[model samples]
Target: MEFHEPVMVREVLSVLRPGPLSRVVDGTLGTAGHALEFARLIGSQGILVGLDRDPAMLAIGARRLNEAKGKDGPRLHLVARPYEEICEVLQDAGMTEGVDAILLDLGVNSLQLENPERGFAFSKEGPLDGRFNTEAQATTMADLVNNASERELADWLRDYADERLARPIARRIAARRALAPLRTTTELAELVREAYPPAQRFGRIHPATRTFQALRIAVNDEMGSVERGLKACMSALAPGGVLASISFHSIEDRITKRIFQGATDAKPDPSNPYSATTTEGLEFELPFRRPIACTAEEAESNPRARSAKLRAIRRMEVTS
Candidate 1:
């Protein structure tokens, strides 16, 4: 897999300001980019715990960290697990009281997206399997497209996958599946592309991009997982500890912004869901009243970071 440049590296480091005696937990250590930076910031007196659900990624991250020099080198602790179980993982490590900071860069990793064999991209030709971990019991993208009824597929696309033309695409997929099951990325992409006119397919980007995104999100429960993971990560922060999250879509960003603003007692108005809530009733406090995005320079350098919305919160007090 090609090395993926970590998006918004400077912003992540700034939000997760580390120092000696601090311990940082990187809940989604894809290539250990953030973990390495966090470890270096915290120094030799501090520790860094890196976690990922994919053992393949964990292996690569371990090698990367091991080869690093100075502070980031051996102070790194690696774990192969999902970010949702962050609380449990920390407790098992005897660090449950929390750590100095926590960072979660949500969505698909570059490693996963670039590898066609991983089936995360329609641009690549591979099996329809989109499981973050091949060992996971969850059904792959293929199972949903091949076995689901037209109504089921449509609902998935409209609700979970957020495809605007979900109904029509689902109808086309169902019709195609009757002749042969959709087993590969190209097969499914072609079906979605076929549902559109040639002009639509030849647009700025493939029309199937959004449809593919919706399917991956559905298959992985990406949005739901972000909600649960954010809460868990906030709960795992030490007093005055920081938690930073980078969300790639509005659905994820809305949740992150609301949670951060509410936790900080900085909710905008009655329209804000947790405007009336108090810190005594919640987990943490937001350090920023609004979500922050990448700078023009960062966006220009990394187009993927353009859609990214970053929000941060700090633990005021540790709950019993």
Candidate 2:
């Protein structure tokens, strides 16, 4: 199936400005949506490396590139791996010096959500595995619902997704699993709905929304990899390289916002609240004062664009 239109494409191109000899990386590389655009801008003179942990997505990306006249386009390298391990990917590609741009598109891609077998959405009835990489050998949503204690599950929901009804939901999940292990997304959603009060049960969003988000993140250990991936992207950039990310929810956006602002805005705690520490003239700068948002038109066309917020930082240029 064709994936949804990528979020904030215009803004991304304007900020990144891929050109000849540019070395760019799409860390998430979900179906090569952004990578395809980068390939066009970079032309045959540049390089665009696509990386995703999912082998299935990688295959799709390769096919997309091939159909897009891969031979005459910017040289493409698609790697099957997560962004956190980008250092290895770059080293293996012999790009040790660095790259010109890097992108980490955080949150669920349309491909996973639309495909029920991956089990990333509660709207469908599928196995409760929410791993980004099916081969990741990590904890699955089913494992959490079946094995974790109510307290453990509740704490996870609260801490991971900030679910306010974590206790009641976790209690219900535990009780339901005791009867029969929750195996499908529909089952979990039903359990969460039952846990909610009647009034809130039929609210605007599915009661299981936050629970699924929390489980997906925990299953993939996304939060744990954010810091590492951010640092890796920064370190992998050549002088004056652009590093960007599009985060869907507040949790990911907050992490990116704080990290981007902190580099140029961090200082001593009390005495210098506005003081920002720079590192050898290499500290990054925020090109846009605020995160770039999707246009109203794009949002109307692609509802997924409504939640996307793009943030970027540019590595400083060397000086005498």
Candidate 3:
């Protein structure tokens, strides 16, 4: 199967200027698109470690990398682990602080959604499975919809998706599940669609888009993973090394913003109510205060690129 094109390719390459001898990490190597580019840039002398939680993605990434120049290509290290486990994987590979740069294109891969079996697309008729790693024992969207209390469901919808009609949607889900369990994507999507009025469905996008995004985020722990993975990337990179991340949603973007902003200096206090000394420690400066996005032309070519926001930071010092 052809993989979805990686978003913000130019920005990623610009942030991670991997030389022929540099070692780079593609922490969220979904389709190996970025990994392949890194391998090509680094040539045979450099090492490109590709990590992903999905076994299928890891297999595909390995095959893609292996097929390209093989013995003459950069040393390919493909790991089936979440990006949060970067430090452990790097240690296992004896890389230590040997990395030159790291990239994390966060959120679900388009390939997963396009494949009916993966169950990521609400438009597709498939199981409600949303786990990045099939081995993960976490509760799926099916379990959430079928088992959670209406109140709990409402809270999740409102908090995660910022949905105004969360209460009604939760009630509808509870009522529907009582008739029968929600086992598939289409079933859940239908219930959510029913929650909206007919006029709302005529809008620019599907009404169930936010709800599906929220469910997937909750099931996969996307925000938590991004925060933890950012820290791991910072720890794994060599001094002066760069770290770049592409977040597609507001929640992920907020986390990236806070982390990148804090890394620049001592974290600001929101609890003290009143505080002085805004200027602080470690010089983790954001190369771009505002995230860089794809051009309109690129977005036209790749619709997925429209939502991608690339944020990069330069590591100045190791925390003592």
Candidate 4:
């Protein structure tokens, strides 16, 4: 899909299990694709908080939300900042009791991937600026590729993207960047393609995909945000409230799973970053131990839904 098509909307709503006239938060409000649905679910008097780091996307989401809202639909409280600021936004909105539901769709939106200028897709040619919040003064892919040390690049690639060819790719990037800075996405993509062996270069996923993902995650501090954002979102949820998050990749899913179960996995692994296990925290209880996956039918229609792993938990009511 060219637009910001939300994956597993029905599944998300089902997992959230929002109550009527309750408050909800669409933490990654790309184009209000999901927020619009949440607005409907909450009724006119309910509150639907929308958040996005990208001003461009927040505007689009706001517009879509406004257009979809019924006369008595939930009020839209859209904010422009990383989802990590979830609690701050809610507190500022004077939400004393917290919210009843929260949905965090942690996928790279089509609004970004399809737009070459955002530099998220390897198939397209564009600048190497892959910051989700384009207006933020954050490090860009170009900055990381050009300035980060060879060892640092390799570690980052391996840690963030689980890229097997991280060492070789980092070496090549370091060498080439020394000659001339890699200013564009194509430049980095081409470098990665050359860095990969012929057998893997022609694989289903492009050679540069992992590197791009890694750089984007690094520039945006996505994993860190997820860590902090989850806690913030949970803290902002009322007792018995539900928090549903859709993780797009393995590492993120692992962290999300681990955190929800109330354990911390801080050690970094170079070979397999996602393999971290721990015990329970007891703040929230998983409705289902297994994460919900998109059905084959849904996966076929929406390619983005294929890798999505939906996990949800309800905050246990505080007892003395």
User: Model 2 residue 186 lDDT?
Assistant: 90
lDDT of 1 by residue, 1-320 (tens): 36657888888888888777788888889888777777666777777888898788888877887777454443667898889999898888888677888889888888888889989888989999888888874789999888878887788778755777898999999888889888999888888988886778778878788777878887887887887787788778878889899888888888888766666654446777644452344456667767788899988988888988888888877556
lDDT at 295, model 4: 92
Residue pairs in clash, model 2:
none
lDDT of 2 by residue, 1-320 (tens): 47746788888888888887899999988888888888888888888899988888888887887689555688888888989889899999999988999988887778888888998998879999988877766778899889988898898799878899999898888778888998999989888888888998998899888999888887887876776687778778888999999988777787777667766674533443223432333567889878888999999988888988889989878766
Per-candidate TM vs. native? 0.91, 0.92, 0.91, 0.91
Query: What TM-score does structure 1 among the candidates reach?
Result: 0.91
- Candidates ranked, most accurate by lDDT first: 2, 4, 3, 1
Q: What's the CA RMSD of model 1 in angstroms?
A: 2.8
Instruction: Write model 4 residue lDDT over 258-288, tens digit each, in one string.
Output: 7776522245344443223222333567788
For residue 320, give model 1's deviation from the true position in Å.
15
Off by over 4 Å in 2: 266-281
User: Which 10-residue window in model 2 sums to the lowest lDDT?
Assistant: 272-281
What is the TM-score of candidate 3? Answer: 0.91
lDDT of each: 0.80, 0.83, 0.82, 0.83
lDDT winner, 3 or 4: 4
**Local accuracy of candidate 3 as per-residue lDDT tens digits, 198-311:** 878657777777777778888887877887788778777777788999988887888787777766645466643212221233356677788899999999988888988998
